[model samples]
Target: MGLRMASGKLRQSFRIYEWLDSHKISVTSIAESIAITPSMVSHTIRGRKNNRRVLKKLVDLGCPQEFLSLPIDLEKQVAA
Candidate 1:
């Protein structure tokens, strides 16, 4: 899983953003859920919500981790 993890940082960040963005979810709400500031998450993904805790929450919200962990354009998956 090293290869996957090695690529996880960017993938995870992007996946997190795409997931939340698509849902029309606000950064403040996401931040509240992850216990982090909206800026921290925003900074991570270029103004998109991107944090490990957020990803875990998204996963818990029914997003399959297998697909989430993959380094793909997550926008398509999470859009409406």
Candidate 2:
């Protein structure tokens, strides 16, 4: 089976996308820098995929670490 998009956009993913846009960073550029396909980079940004190399490169390029990991639901955690 193929990977499918998440039903809802992840919080971290949205933040990362916004940060990339604000910084004028393009998925194509990141992909080229890492020798990966643009689709893979896009997928990673959208939370449909995970790639350590891509994540590392984003951080190296000044992306905030908070936007690179899954978001924790503090409310849910407190309730649990």
Query: Which candidate has the highest lDDT of all?
Result: 2
Regions of model 1 farther than 4 Å from truth: 1-5, 9-18, 43-51, 64-67, 70-80
What would the per-residue lDDT of candidate 1 be over residues 1-74, giving only the tens digit for each residue?
32333335444556655767788877687678878887874654442333556555566566556445533334
Q: Pick by TM-score: which candidate is best?
A: 2
Question: Model 2: what TM-score?
Answer: 0.69
Q: Candidate 2: where are CA atoms >4 Å away?
A: 1-11, 70-80
The alpha-carbon lDDT assigned to residue 59 of candidate 2 equals: 71
The global Cα lDDT (0 to 1) of model 2 is 0.71
* RMSD in angstroms between candidate 1 and the native structure over all alpha carbons: 7.5
lDDT of 2 by residue, 1-80 (tens): 43323422453877888999999999999999999999999887877776656776887788876666633332233236
Which pairs in model 1 have colliding backbones? none
